[model samples]
Target: MAVSNQEQTPVEAEERGARARTARLMLDTAVQLMQGGIVPSVSDVAEAAGVSRATAYRYFPSQAALVQAVVDEALGPILDWKSASVEATERVGDLLSSSLPRIDAFEATFRAALKLSLDQWAQRQAGTQGSEPQFTRGHRIDLLRDAVAPLRGRIPEAGLDRLGKALSLLFGIEALIVIKDIWGGSAEEAREVVLWAANALMAAAEAEADKS
Candidate 1:
């Protein structure tokens, strides 16, 4: 029996909704485990969430995949960040201010993701990471590029790219780990350092642009 498109549309939507709900459940479970200082595998999360292993595996095939999903969820707000300001410096400042607090709050989760990525790197170096999906991290690139869009023509193309890359260092978990953990700075101190570095980078870029 052939189903009309209209008849199948609602069914497909419902199925998608169900899948999304299940995936969210697993992610939430994973985050909880991560917060408790446990790096959970997909099977661990599935068992905790009361979901079937096969269905959970369909959503996150490995520990790396599961942790990556949790990290992405933690960073969902930053990924959707938008600024209406046309001033590149203001736009970048706003993004850093808005995102730094979120990163501080999820410090543990982000550090865990970093640890997993480093573990993968080490395993690959030892030729032990056979066919496992790698969890790559790059959200800061697009966000920084968008923040500096107003400076696109003002700065040389290579300069714009360099600015974005430099700003990326100040935007994410790495900054928190450095300023807060390694340097023993408070959250407020970390934010100040990041803002200072970001502004300095912009000023240097602007100065170079003036010379050129």
Candidate 2:
């Protein structure tokens, strides 16, 4: 019997969906092992993901490759910030503040990314840069400025500088360690710190503007 075009499309779509699910499951297992300090092996991950060693190996050829892909997928939300235009710089802070909730939501993923980045850096023979994408810090700063731009008159130079520093430091490795590893705060707490800091800066900016 000949398959109709309509039936073929659904079959193709199902295949795509199944592949996506399998890929995601593999990624999730890798992340879980990473989080647990297990240094996930292919066999371990395969078992966790409920797939055969052959299937797991087919999907991820090596530990580094699997780690790279999982970390990339995990950081997708933050790295893909939608910058409408260069004019976005003016309101970077606001846009960044809006992402505070999202930041909290993905704290585990973020924590795992920090570890992966460090591992990559260590492999660079101690002086070279890490394997992680460079956009993390730069993008965060860019978005911060964009969110704060509309309140420029309200935000003093010192205040803006402080805000930038906070975003770079608190929102990066430092905060990842402090909140996730040391303090053991939930994702919500991590995000709240960022949001509160941003809002405080905005409030201070507003106060300064009022004095003018």
Candidate 3:
């Protein structure tokens, strides 16, 4: 018996929905494990998610892949960052103010992601990471550029790039960890300090642009 196209369409849609649900379950489980400070392997995520190892591996073939998925999920909001401000400083401030709280909320997950990246770095340095894919980090670059987009015409291209680099230093989990953990500041204090530094850096960049 030949199956009609209409019948096959619904079947395909149902299959896709099931696959998406399973993937989401695995990702959510991986994130929860990361938040608990356990850098989960695919199999670990499978067990915690009550999914079969085979199924979980199908979604994320390696620890690096799994961890990256969780990191991307944790960064969903920040990645979608938007601001209505026309001023470069104001846009940067809005981005920081809105994102700092989110970063603090997922501090543990971000720390775990950072740990994985550092571990991969150390392994590569020691010539022990083997053929495993390295965990690279750099989402802040684009976000910072977007935050400072309003200054492109006003500042030189070099100045804009320098401003982005300076702002990146004060943007992500690294900054929060430094300000909160190393400096023993509270979350609010860290946010305040980062905003202050971010604005200061922008002001300096603008002044430098004026001079040039």
Candidate 4:
């Protein structure tokens, strides 16, 4: 079916532009609040952005929407990452090298996101989660699988999955926090350790594939 023309009228266009500006303002405010390690609600962002609660709610609708927008903004570059290397280990190293620093830079925001995820988990366990949307996290799974794509035909699917799970323990904000916070190591140390672990996992996967 040929789609009919549905262009907006001049007034409608102007209204859309205004709404877009307001949404951007609210989203920017949310990012700023999250950067301070605060998983802000829509009302919090509205107050910070000087926008009315009604208007902010119109754009974000819920805390889940607002926090998710901030996460997508923070995750933009890492999600778009691609490697030129053909070797699985080298590609994994490249990804870690490129992504760890970015993750470090947004450390506070990610930690705040993690806090939200954990809070939702606890609330759910207590049956007090109410209608609040649960915060979700698992981007590392797909990323790790892609990084290890070179082993697709070499290893069993279960082996590849296990490798992804193992490497995940060494990736993301948790890795940085464990190395930097618990062990009192620096960001560089975290990066080196993650890179080393990822390479080791790749080697293990390749060896397992050889046995198969």
Whose TM-score is greatest here?
Answer: 4
Q: How accurate is candidate 4 locally (lDDT)?
A: 0.87
TM match of model 1 to true structure: 0.90
Q: What lDDT tens digits, residue by residue, belong to model 4 across residues 121-185? A: 88999999999877778888888889989889898888888888898898799999899889999
How do the residues 1-212 of candidate 2 rate in per-residue lDDT, one tens digit apiece? 78776666676889989988998899888877765655566688999999999989888876666766655665567666655543323345445555555555555655565665566567665655544333222455765555555555555778766766655665554564677678888656776675566567656666766786
Per-prediction backbone clash count: 0, 14, 0, 0
TM-score of each: 0.90, 0.53, 0.92, 0.94
lDDT of 2: 0.63
Judged by TM-score relative to the true structure, which candidate is superior, 1 or 3? Answer: 3
lDDT of each prediction vs. the true structure?
0.88, 0.63, 0.88, 0.87
**Model 4 Cα RMSD, 1 decimal:** 2.4
C-alpha lDDT of residue 70 in model 4: 92
Candidate 1 wrongly placed segments (more than 4 Å): 6-18
Minimum summed lDDT over a 10-residue window in model 1 is located at 2-11
How far does residue 116 in candidate 4 sit from its true spot (Å)? 0.7
User: lDDT at 199 for candidate 2?
Assistant: 65
Give one digit per residue, the lDDT tens place, for model 1 in 83-176.
9998888999999999988888888888888888889999999999998899899988999999999888877899999899889988888888
Candidate 4 lowest-lDDT run of ten: 1-10
Alpha-carbon runs more than 4 Å astray in model 4: 1-6
Clashing pairs in 1: none
